[model samples]
Target: MTLELSEPADVDLEAVRRVARAGEPVRLAPAALAAIGRRRAEFVAFVEAHAGDHLYGITTKHDVAARTVLDDAARAEFGRLLPPTPPSPSTLGPALPERVTRAAVLARLTDILHGTAAIRAETAARLTTLLDGPLPAVPEGGNGDPGDVVALGRLLRPAFQGTLEVGEGMALINGSPMASGVLADAVLSGRDRIARLEQVLALAAVAACLPDMHVDAQLGVLWGDPHQERVLARYRELLAGGTWPRRAYQAPVSFRSAPRVLGGVLRTLAHAQDAATTTLRAASNNPVFVGPDLRPPLGAVLSNGGYHNPLVSPTLGALAHAWADLAQLVTAQLNRLTDPPDGIAAHETEPRTSLFPMTASGWAEQARAAAAPGLVGLGRSGQTDTSTPDVLAWRRATDAGAALDALLGLLAVTATHLVTRRGDTPPPALAGLRDAVLECYPLDTPPLDVAEALDAVLAHLAAR
Candidate 1:
């Protein structure tokens, strides 16, 4: 399917997921393309009319070279030159995954289509053309030097840097689109983890005969948290018509409060999504065109706002911290459910699942350590320092989500293990999930790698 870039503001998490994970093709709408072309022409006319004027990335160089004047030859050379990107000491790792890079590439295309970047239509078209195939490797670490210019350059270098014009080079690399796209992809995947965990809860609840009062919708009104209701609503749907213990003994705190813990995580996830949405639609190019929609169009003006996206940093941190809390909650449930002095795993003995809680405990520790907010720092240029560790923050949150995925999958595996060992019957509604979980058999070490077992279960859980 083709995604048209007409109203760029309409681009959201699902769009990024489709393009990045599903490899959907992108197309700029005719109107947006024409507007981009006209804006590019108008910008050129504006520059020619004001010859000898100093432009941040056009007639003059950037950063420490800000004051350096360039003749026409130097200007042309500067335009095509992919400047050395300062090393990212804070972010150290492999290139961004292809899906994340593809998300960033798709994000950059939206900015060009916004008509504020003043890039030639051909450049934008060329970028979209390349989106049809394999994407270049973008480094995971980068200085927030007016956005991920270093990584953006590597992605664009093969077909892009050779013919860049004045200001066009900056337009290509300038902005927080990389951060935006990373957050978009992270939020999408994080939501999937949340859903999978919910399913795990469904299976566990039925297996334990978790108290109905815990999932009762009225409890949401009593709790006073707006997100609580939606979580309970889903639980109610999944648990409806499920058999419950006739005695109605209260479940342990781990079983009772899981929804509340999840409700709080949902709040934090929404916060990250709000921040991602803002960054995703941002046309945050340096030297951005001032009046592209004007009758004659105003030329570009350089400002520090293009690269100043601190909100993304803390929002990512928040997500990591949230998952850390969830990991702890999952660990508690795992412990109670495993030995089941008497809750979910009542009268159950699954020796193989003994280490599952520890695995989740370890992940919780890792995510907590990585949850520090992005550090804001001054750069070598000493000129601008709106730099936030967005790249690092994005990595932290993405890794946290993965950790949560494993923790929840392990929980699901444990629940299935006990239920099958006891030959229990779950609610009719959970029959399919039971079948899927049953397929994740032989979790013991003879042939199945625990990780592989979890992977099989996770793959099935993800499908639901």
Candidate 2:
């Protein structure tokens, strides 16, 4: 998977998803690295050729009025004059600059692809290395301003010692990197988590044995919709030949419309995936090159909000909300499973009658009894804070992350019971999926302990 800058490459959705959801590493393709190297060399050459001329960030000093042009020899010396250190601590602290440095490196790479940014090949290589390397720890405490550009400038000054020239220094430091780094990580993770969580919502409905109308009808609606048919198909593939559907017929109305609820979740996950993909491939920079030329032969460069990451924050928040919604759904499924009154059993007349002996007083009810509070608390906090955008936007995101782990615990228990009840007659898809989840992200808590808590919650649901 070599990605070439000359001809655009498919933004690796899997890579983005893995990093965002699993907190994995990010890597650039050989072609991408090679392209960046070539561009870096060209940029450095251009700087070396016109070193004496007056340019925005190159020959002349930055954050100052453009005055006289310096010769190529003096330009190198002029670049050495570091700006005065701020008297007070920066407000945003080190996080802002860490992000900016990250973004600047990315921007520089993009600019290299455009045959601009006039840096060296080694510089581009170093930038890519930095992108793929461990993110250095950034001190959080400071007192200057919210933007924190100066802090970023100071941190980047050392890393960029041999690489940056006149305008390159300003170019690297001028844009929003902190937000970019956060946004990149956030969106990438959001995409990955949403995909699985949305699927979990569907599985939760199936586990609840909800009504077929609520379950499959929603899937039908999703199938009819333009974009969701693919995801709906995946769900169908997951459920085919499973005894869960037959078991649902014996349950209450809670089992109905399960598909629709899950389908909606799938739809939302699709949106998050799309948004994340778009952001990942986007070039967020300022003073972009017009064409093949790094230093344009004529006219000033183009500068705009292309690099401003306002959309990433909101999208990240939205993805988090979707996860919260799915978590609540999972909690509801845990409620049905653990409640004895809910009566989870396959009808004797159903096709898979040989799968299990109907049992009302199984592990579900008992498990719910112990696990209910954490689930309830998570649900309440998520809903309580939804009164304003601040709650839904920020507070909910935090709550959703916690909710995901809790729900994973619940799902593990439910799947365990399903495996126990099915014996040898279980569908391969369901059996394989259960095994996969267990093997991949094993329950953080003892299944029996979590099941008991689920039992407590089930009791609460029955009381309600």
Candidate 3:
């Protein structure tokens, strides 16, 4: 399918996911191309009218030497020279997945289309062609300072040699779109993880046979939050027709508070989504173009810091921390299932032999450690910018991915144990999940790789 990009705000998680994961084609709407052309002309007029004005990184040097002014010839030289200034050597690691690189390229293109970066319409069209064609391999590391710029230059220099104009290369390289794309992918992944988490929580609740009275719809109303209402509604739907008697008046805090806990996660994921959407639509370059939306638009090329994203850093940190909390809750549910209070031991063997619980605990610990905020630093580079939202969002995405894997593993193990204890008759809501679990990890055999199992479960859920 041809994914349309008429406005940056229209590019959401699913849009990025389709291109990044599904290899879908992308196109700029006719209106976007026209607006880009007009904006580029306006920027040129503004530049010619204000030739003596000091513009950071455009008419003048960046960083501490902002006072240095450059003539038109020098400005052109600056564009050519600045991209290679922070030459980054490649390091050893897996290259960024093609989907992510494509998403980043498209995201940068989206920013340029917003007309704030003042890139030429032809440059935007070339970028679209690059996205439509094969992309160069992007190595990991070199993500500090202008590392993204350097990496982008390396990736696109082969294609954009004769096509790009002055200052456009810097505009392409000097923003946080790569990081925005990374966060966009994370948001998509997090949406999947959140859905999976809800499924597992429902499975655990039904497996434990917690009393339906506590999860009543009235309780959701009394809770007085949209998140609680939504979660309670889902729990009620999932736990419907469960015939098993309650294990106790209240099973445990984990079982009782399942809706509330998952609700918090859902809310935080929404916040992350909002932050990512705003960043996706924003002009994250140094000197943004500001003018009225008309021909011969009067505007100024003023220096700004839209690239340093304050919203994404905290949103990512919150998502990581929220997932960690959910991990602990899942771990607690596992404990309850393994060691029920009624003396009916689910696992007759010792805790060491009971690999499921032990594995879940280990995964939970790793998630908690990974949840530490990535924004805690005094900043680096000569600019001394304290927070690196790009790096933080990347790390947070990794952490959230790992946590999702571990959570899926725990859910599979929990579902398997529940089936074993109850003689293969899982509740209707969990019947499909049970089948998936057993297929990935048969009862007679040891569990497979958790990551592999997670991939299967995610695929299963997506297919459903």
- Candidate-wise lDDT, in order: 0.74, 0.45, 0.70
Query: Sorted by TM-score, highest first, which candidate order results?
Result: 1, 3, 2
Model 3 residue 115 distance off true place after TM-score fit, in angstroms: 1.5
Estimate the TM-score for candidate 2.
0.61
Best by lDDT: 1
State the lDDT of candidate 1 residue by residue for 1-464, as single tens digits: 98888767857788898888999988888888888888888888776665477777767787768677688788888887655555444346587888888888888876786777888887888888877999876767664654777677778777776687877887887777787877887788778777777878877776566877878888999999988778898888887774445226887787788888889989988888888888888887776766535544455565557766767778888888888777777777777777645443454334454557667778777767767666776665476545667777878887777677777787787776666656666666676777786677443443336667767887887776
CA error at residue 318 for candidate 2, angstroms: 1.5
In candidate 3, what are the lDDT values of residues 1-464, reduced to their tens digit? 88888887767677788888888888889899899899888887777777687876667766666687888887777655434534445665567777778878877876676677888787787778877777987765556553256557667777766555555766777777777777777687788776667777887776677787878889878988899899999877776664555655777898888889888888888888888887777778867777665433578775666666666667777877887787888888777777755311444444423666677778888778868766535656666455464654566556755765666666655655564556645567767777787676554443335446546665665554
On TM-score, the leading prediction is 1
Span of 10 residues, lowest total lDDT, candidate 1: 342-351
What's the CA error at residue 85 for candidate 1, in Å? 2.4
- Against the true structure, candidate 3 has what lDDT? 0.70
* Runs in model 1 lying further than 4 Å from the true structure: 87-92, 142-146, 244-247, 292-300, 343-351, 384-386, 442-451
Is candidate 2 or 3 superior in TM-score?
3
Which of the predicted structures, 1 or 3, would earn the higher lDDT when compared with the native? 1
Candidate 2 residue lDDT tens string, 1-464? 32223422333354433433343433455676676556555545555665565554565654333466766676776554433334334343434333323443443344444444434455555655665554444444431222224444555555675555555555555444443344454444444454454345445545555343433436556458634455455556655565654453444433343344545655665665565555545554444434335345532345454434445446546556555555554555555655443323331123122111122222233223322221111212421221112112322344454455455455544544544444423345556545544454333435344345545433322222
TM-score of each: 0.91, 0.61, 0.88
* Evaluation by lDDT, superior candidate among 2 and 3: 3
**RMSD per model, one decimal:** 2.7, 10.9, 3.2
